[model samples]
Target chain A: MSNFPPAGVFLVGALLLPLVPRRVRAVALLMPPVASLVLLWILEPGQTLTVPFLDFQLLLTRVDRLSLAFGYVFVIVTFLGGVYGLHLKDVGQQVAALLYSGSALGVVFAGDLFTLFVFWEVMAVASVYLIWARGTKRSRQAGYRYLFVHMAGGSLLLAGALIHYNATGSLLFEPMKGGLGATLILVSFAINAAIPPLHAWLPDAYPQGTVTGSVFLSAFTTKAAVYALARGFAGWEVLVWAGTAMAVYGVVYAVLENDIRGILAYHIVSQVGYMVAGVGLGTEVAINGTTAHAFTHILYKGLLFMGAGTVLYATGRSKLTELGGLWRALPLALGLYMVGAFSISGFPLFSGFVSKSMTVYAAEVDHRGLVVLLLNLASVGTFLHTGLKLPYFTWFGPSRPAAPQTRVPWNMYAGMGLAAAINIAIGLYPGLLYELLPFPVDYRPYTFAHVSETLQLLLFTGLGFWLLIKMLKGEPIITLDTDWFYRRPARLVYVIAVVYPSHLFATTERIALRLVQSLVSASRDPIAALNAATVTLFGRYPDGRMPRRRHNTGDYDPDRYRLPVGVMGLVILALFVALMLWILLAR
Target chain B: MKSTWLVLVVVTLVLTVSGDILTRKGEYGQWWYPVPGFFALLGLLGCMAIVVVSKLLGRYWLQRREDYYGDSGAGE
Candidate 1:
């Protein structure tokens, strides 16, 4: 484990993927994540593999409890993603997935800001290809938007990291005190965490990615941001409110969304809000809850995306309006998806129950009543959308008999089943997750009171869903989001500022060139040039006569100003001498 | 679907009743424990609020045609 960076396994696997035989590629893809997971468990906690980078010591592997926890889950999700993508024939997506997952792991274990920044950019560049590999015109455009947003985020992170280093004179990744640098760093992390109004990219791009690629996309990027926040800006009070707002904001948008993946993408914003709030609360249990939630969110969210992906793989549709009666065609997927749904809604005996409740509980203990209320409200909304509404409409709503049931790949089910099983296992035996948390486990999730209270909440939310079933029906319309502000205006601005100006300059240059050419040709014979200039300036010939036209009234013959070559030379030399004398006298 | 509904109702009844008997602990325990089906009411109202708020947003602000951003070539 000390021999090299753990992420190196995946990086090397990505490089070797193209050379491998097609028959063996799938198996080759699975090896790196497994190897990285093994390396994660074997590596000891502390900074290792330091190298001199300019004025700083680059700590490539910081094997602390927090990083290790993130590493464990990242490798697990990568393996699951590899299994889910086994059927894909696109080599570009395969390599991109490997690099993307590898870079996320690099961010997890990065000990210094510099190492983190490098991996941050690699994650952005690598993940955008996953969106592009969907190979749709819309996906191509969405990928560009995704890349631009992330590049902006990366620039902010770089700027913040440099300023932070300048202020502290150290590059070690640690908790930051309040200042412009810290605020900038926090804003950068907030962007990746998908806090509104910086959020729209996740919902914009994730749905546009390939099925398996969306699964990977959902797991890595924001979770890495949560890790960065937990490591760097824990206990910042502002995050508490921002995160609370995000929790409610995400579900509200998700409620109005028609696309299956769009709803889930927004819910990612909602779920991550729990972790951000926990980090902001800054209690031991809160941090513990944040880590636990991130770990479970990866599994359950990946499962949800996988479930939706399977639907997409089969029916070639992801909108709720087009999908129905999938429970019959994809019974296995329906059951597995419900597990994720229930888990995310914080139903009893599921991963979300054990993880998400801790954050709310921490807030209550801290006497942050408003935060508690907001988190609880968000939970109710979570159940309303993901747990009840999504499953209801996608699986059991109006039948679509015209749609063919395409065969889903076995590895897809295998991946989802594995994630579902883990979710249940962790939910039931939270100690399995608790021991991996950065802080000690003191809170219990399974008291009779908690169990009963949570059940009552979820069941009644189910009751609400049933009551509002008619109103909850999906429509074939899009709900404008913050992305609209950019999607429409940004294109207009780009055309005007960038595209139109360049085109205008090109046209102007062409006209200018033509005018210059005519001037140069006229200057070749100075007497004709002088005659034309005089005619244009004075509307008469140099001889005080109207310019004589040939057959066409406006056309003039060059013979009208024809002079001996010697006389033309003499005229040009005399003008030059007169200009030189004027310049000499003026000086 | 009927059986699922039946199971949900039964579960909700059992939990609400059992919650009445269970000893509550920690912050807000007094307020929450004394109120029968407190979380249930909260969940119900919360879900309703979400639907109402989202519907209002959709109707007034957020909703748009399927081609609201225009065709795929619009931005291009």
Candidate 2:
């Protein structure tokens, strides 16, 4: 059992997928995650699998409640996403999904920084393909930016791992004492967590991913970063404010976004804030809240992405301005999507209700008044944008004549139905989720006061939506985000770094090619070549280039171009002597 | 249909605000919990403010055309 780690299942499954017949590929996709879930369920806490490398132990499988909590969701989402994409014939996307989820699983279970770093980098490389799979000009550019950003983050994580190992002579990935290494490591996690300023890549890229790929994309990367922060940087005070700022930041952008996936992408930043803040609180309840929220978030967010994906899949458009009156056409998609919207809004009978309250309650208990207030405000925005604004303008707004439609595939519906059921089940019986939380729980989602508080907050948000509905419809425009700080200047950088240099290289290469051709012709007919060069250089031309019409004017004649044997031997001998003399003199 | 939807939102809002007000913050909620509809209005007004402020930011500062990033690479 120790010899085979859980990540190996998905990773190995990905490598073997092409061998499987195309017709059954989607069914094949479900097998690995199913196997991973069973393996994780059977593996008890306190299990460790270690492999030796150099002077350090690579702890590849560290099974405990924390890893178990993340492990379960990673595989669950992989299975759900597989079902969502069951209609896909694109093997590239299938392989990427498997590999990306496998790496995420690897990160959670890894006990050493080295192990974490390897999987961290693999996760980045694999997930970028999802964005690139769309093969549009926009997706191509976005994929490059996503790849570059994540690679930069991965580099920081690797540097932190090296520096920490050098200082402490240990690589165990656990809570760190403050230093350069820990700071670098925290920033790396922050980037992946989509903490603002660093967050623009997310909304920039996720909307560009393939429909099924976006569903997988929405589930994994930021949540995995949340898991890492929970493991490494819990109680770091800066995270409390950073997380709070992100919560509001995401909500604000969600309001402004014209793209539906873009709106959901921004909210990923918003939802992750609670988990990061809980990690910052570092209380037992807070950690439990963080884990529980992560678990519920992956499911509901996947459902939302699947819902949006169904819209995009059927209509071939994702912008809210181009989408409307879809309720008549995509009713099932709307119903399933509303389940997600309700869950994310923390409606009383959904999974988010059970989970989201715990983090806020923890903040209140910790007496962090500002974090509590700001997170609450973010929620108001959350319900407003995701629940009311997006749906209002999308499914229930005035129909656009341009929008096209097709019947959504059953697998997409099957995928969304499964996610919606899980969300409602957890909402109805909180213990279903609570039992899996890393810490013992005493929080209740359905207390008279708590439910009343949630209802007023969400209901008034709905009222605000109805009143503001006219202003809330998406314009056919893009909004500038923090990405503008980089994206606007990216072309300038491309010119300076790529365009100008390539142009210079091309000119140089042309001149060098002319010189090499001249020298080759000279070696063949030395007398004629020298006379031509002399005329060009000293009289006819200012430049040293031999005239193109001189020497071999017609097609090359191999026999005529050959140098004499004696002259070739002399040249080789001269080259050998020069090399020997230069070596002797330099020594 | 729109007016009916508006009325539904209003009635639900009224019911929840009253329920919150009736519930006792008797022992331990902070000063604002005693205020009926405090969170409700906060939700309403807060989201309204978010929309207004965000739109203002968009109009003045943040919004741009789809090709704002020079995505076509034409001029570049």
Candidate 3:
């Protein structure tokens, strides 16, 4: 029942997840929550235990309200995602999910940044295999990009940890004053949260992952970063802008995407924006908003992805262009997905409206008028894309001729139904959500003004969408985003500037080698020499010039030796190399 | 092209003006920046206006094919 034992149990379960016999993988899936239940029930708040390391004692777990709240949600998500992924059949993916989710759980409960970073990097390395599990060339490329981005984040996190340790001479994960160390840690966490410029990977990788794999991917990384941000940099104030930037950025990009999964992927970042801005405000209300939003976000986002995943599995299509008119056949899935979409758009009587408004409410109380206003606009934008575009394009648009209406498995429906029910349950009753909040809860959500305003914001946004559709007649297509800056023209520049030159240099080297071989062969051939003599020495007399040039042995005369074309080519090559080296030396 | 840029410039100006107005309250003819909230509002309004107008203008410029570059899985 000790903290070390729980860690050991979870670690062992993760290690054994893939090694188990294929027939029993489903049974093995239940191991994670059991370990979680043990940890949760055994470790009381304020309980501390240490494992002896070389010169210091490593605190295995420090149970607190913040850590406990995150731990509880992660455990629940693991169970739900596992149930959704039951049909995955890929043992490697199952094990990776377990280990990756377990490591994230370890991070929140960790007493220090060192423990957090260890699990942080583990989650990064373990999760990429999920992307690779798709077994396509695109998936491979996405996996590689995913690896580089997360590894860069890990390095930044390590650097921040070292800087913080040096500054405070302690590794405890607590609030730090603004400095290079703090900024490094914050930026590092933001990258994982999929902040702009670095955010392309979220959509790129998540959509390419296996149908079930995306469910797990959606919940962990951003939420873990939120936990870290809450732990280390709460009330720092800069997060408000960062969070706001991300929220809007996500909505714009989501509006532009055609892939259903990609649309959901962008919304993940958008929803997290509210949390980041809330935490940045750093009041009791703000922090509570962040935690509450995180809890609700995990459920609704997972539900959305699961719905998209079901479509992908049943139809073998995910792009909006190839889908429509499934509302009749997959009514259960479509209905569940709509709950998720409504919750995300912050509609009245849904989870998003309750949780998202809390952040805006906090901003208003702090007299943060601008934050409140922008967040409201983002709420409207969320309504436009997720609320309207996602469900409309997928289930109600112009129908594809042969779209499938196959029934999804029972467990998948069970998982989505469970999450959607909770989403609605929380929306109708904020008290349940409030009790789970890490901080003391005093905020109310059922006021008449709040309800009316939320309805107005969402309805007006829907009206704008209708107006745009009527006036401009915009067709649904995959609009390019920040990825274009890196994927297209910039990628072209990289190829020309880097790959093209290297390829050219390689070709030139091959040509030079061929030219040298031709020269060496020509020097050894008498007939070739005579032919060369006619062209180079005499210009018109071949027989007479060769007779006059005949030496004692087979052709050792330097005068008879006219430079072959191949030799001239080699000379040109040498000159070019020398010039290149000279230029390099000069520089 | 010219009209799109003009629209973008106008939106940027509107956003900047709104940002300034919100950041500064009419407090005895004195003006100051209202730090994080001001920038957050700027970002939000900028994103929304960009979405609405872009959708309007994208109708003119952004042409996409039903299956322009079908899933070729750009690879070796």
Please compute DockQ, using alpha carbons, for every candidate against the native two-chain complex: 0.53, 0.53, 0.07
How many steric clashes does model 1 contain? Answer: 0
Model 1 per-residue lDDT tens digits across residues A403-453:
646899899999999999999999889999999998778999997777877
Residue A478 of model 3 has an lDDT of 51
Residues A109-140, candidate 2: write the lDDT tens digits. 99999999999999999999999998888998
- Compared with the true structure, what per-residue lDDT tens digits does model 3 show for residues A288-310? 89988898899889999999998
Q: Which candidate leads the pack in TM-score?
A: 1
Q: Distance from true position, residue A42, model 3, in Å?
A: 3.1
Q: What class would a CAPRI assessor give candidate 1's docking?
A: medium
Q: How displaced is residue A490 in candidate 2, in Å?
A: 1.9
Compared with the true structure, what per-residue lDDT tens digits does model 3 show for residues B1-76?
9999767755654554444444444322212233323333333444357576656544555435533334355342
DockQ, prediction 1: 0.53
Share of real interface contacts recovered by each model?
A: 0.68, 0.71, 0.10
Ranking by lDDT: 2, 1, 3
Better of 2 and 3 by DockQ: 2
